[model samples]
Target: MTRHQTSNNRAVLRTAAVPARKTLGGGGAAFLAALLLLSCSNPSGPKRNEAKIQGVVYRNDTRTPVPGATIVLERPVSVATAGEGGSYSMAFTADTTYITNVIATMPGFRSDTEQVVVVPQKTSTVDLYLRADTSSPVTPSQSGDAANIYLVDFTPEFISVSGTGANDVAKLTFQVRDAHGTPVDSAHGVTVAFSITNGPSRGEYIFPSSAPTDPRTGKVTVSLNAGTKSGVVQILATAQVGTKMIGSEPVRMTIFGGLPDQAHFSIAPQMYNFPGLDWLNRTDQIMVLVGDKYSNPVQPRTAVYFETAGGVVDASGYTDAAGLAGVTLRSGNPIGNDPVYGPGFAYLKARTVGENGATVKDSILILFSGFPTEMTLSPSSFNLPVGDQAGEVFTYRIADRFGHPMAEGAAVNVTSDGAPVVLSGDVNLEFPDTQSSSWTTFHFKVNRKESDPGAKSGNVAINIKVTGQNGNRSISLTGYVAY
Candidate 1:
């Protein structure tokens, strides 16, 4: 009996055990020679140049087998599952030394990877050890080597306030533990020292710069205050226990200077309509604030310049004591060259300088409230069967000048072009009547006309005319159908 197996794209024959024959005479010798020649001449004969890989998966903590672990071979991409004893094996062609990547993975444990080499006709043994992920909640040994140390609270991750006098503070907590994850208690105090690893300027620890861990508990708490300049603030802690030094995890904090790296703006009464006229006459109170890298308000009396894109505003102003600047934005006439309108956006920007001489700027967008400037047809193209009463449905999304969804109950009129397609009820266009925050959606269906004789595959166009309290706008799109 013969069994066939494939490895590395090559067919291999595994033959059953056979009995050996005793020494033969001249006839038997001649027969044996003929058989050897036949095998040698057969180009399709099975070759014996193959190798195997065997491995065991074990847990790093407990020198025990890790059954059900998955092991993968990189070259040729083969995988094997470990059996009861955590043993796995794979066979591959070894025409050349097989240098391959081997990886082992198990749930709740970190995967292990190794490089292996297999030679022809040989079984190479490779082993892997997977470690338990520390992030999971596992009990720590009562008494063992230190396993982990981490920070508890590094709050106020960022501070926009500059200067230590401003009380821009953050809290820091540290915990020490052993290999089994059990907190380590020190009979004598464990001296933990803190330092700033990186930042624009080294920040100061509020008090007790170097403190001893609680004897009963293995924890410590401290506070940090911002530095004079603007930049990232990083802190590191280390515990000195006897002759050994244990390091706590690092933490980062950001501080903003009085000089503005960024600014914020707000506008009141954002929407207005043009009634029987091209221009809308309105005024909006705009406020701007300058903040430093740490988010701290800039110094008082900073000058901010106001600019406009589609509107006009007070050109220049000074930031108040609160780092806020106020300006009156007005929309003049709705002229071709005017900067503001009902169906468009009016942009206002406030520019200032930081205490560090850095340029700071912020801008706000106001949508001239009125009719939508643009309309979109979802699935602009769709398929419909000719003569089918049920037509394809498309979603029409309406947006205002600032790309925001039109207010509820906005008015729109729909009409069609060409004979193949028409509005379902003479006028299919209308306001979505939706209260959606982003955009409104209305369903419209297009059907093939029954009276048209040349009903094959063709396209139909739909035109939309929207009338807002301010003005009117138009848009068009097409749909498709097959007979």
Candidate 2:
């Protein structure tokens, strides 16, 4: 009898043919010959014991098939080539179950190895994933290369300074890649380090400053915590490969929103006193300035509310970058009066929400004065001798209804009907101080010239007019110029 066997694609033959026995009868010999012929002619043969290993080869980064990859079996030293679809199959005759390593490799990719077990007459499946070799061999004298390192993604790019919940922390992810943009992991001897390049002093911190790249994804993630200060933060990631260092572009994050504090909150008026009595066109500017507990300006667009005891004020305004907000107070009816400051005085208040969710307020005194209700002229008439070049002085006083001086910038004009007399004095009035009387006074010098026509008429009328915020007053006095 002749037997044939195959293992690992190699053939082996064994022959077991018996010589015809002389002692046997001719019939027996014929029967034996028939049996031999029958055995040789039979189509059915002994079943061969075989085991197979088959699977697909894929790229680690993209999970895509890697065609033309070479597959090798270590124990029996058998080799197979992957087909167009990255599929490979290896079959071998096995008498017993055994363990072996299967390695997959391709050009420009790192080899992958997986341990597999083969059972007699049983098929085992094993898949392999390969990574791209993005780095070149480096010498000990060379510096580290970080060209393949990248800061891929970051979360919460804008956060509040030391805020709670989602606004308190940020997440950053970095990847190491090869020249072909394939992800390379720690298996390729790549590591990453993180740092804060530009940020507020002691205002931010990161966790796991240094770490090895992930073997599967070639990525590393870290957390950044915001501090008490508000400003911009910049982070950098560096890849360390052998002796070379590769750095990625820096990433920027912002920390904003500082709440207002009472110590730094204030209200100011452009002027303490304005002509806001009954003059609807008159207006005053009121401003509010706010700052955080750290003495930094509050965030822009913060809301501020305004209220006044008298007149009309803008209801609301928003702060600017400088933490300043302004509103206009227009003159109207219902003038406010203060017992101490007298008439035209009102309380103006500004308020905002603080960090603690409480209302922060500031108040200031604003005085709105109207036209003067009383006016007095000393002597009521001017007496000048003819050819008197040395001018005679006269005084006039004006006051509001509450015995307070009219608002500043009141105008006074004096003229003579018969002749133009030379007059010298201030044409505008200034607000009176607390130490001074409530009346605002003006003085003028009246001169009679020898060539004056008023001296020839012997009787001249002195005309005086005063203009106030909401009204005007006129006075006429008869003056005699003796000849």
Best-fitting candidate, measured by lDDT?
2
Error of 1 at 23 (Å): 84
Off by over 4 Å in 2: 1-192, 199-257, 279-283, 328-334, 339-343, 355-359, 371-376, 386-391, 398-422, 428-439, 448-483
Please, what's the RMSD in Å of model 2?
22.6
Candidate 1 minimal-lDDT segment of 10 residues: 15-24
Model 1 lDDT, residue 158, Cα: 50
Measured with C-alpha atoms, the lDDT of residue 121 in candidate 1 is: 80
**TM, every model:** 0.31, 0.53
* CA RMSD, predictions in order: 24.5, 22.6
Model 1 lDDT per residue over 96-158, tens place: 664556667666666676666656787767776666546422322233444456786666555
Computed on alpha carbons, the lDDT of every model, listed in order, comes to: 0.59, 0.68
Q: Estimate, for each residue in 363-431, the C-alpha lDDT of model 2 and write its tens digit.
A: 988777666777777777767775667767778777666555665555677777665466677534444
- lDDT accuracy of residue 293 in candidate 2: 74
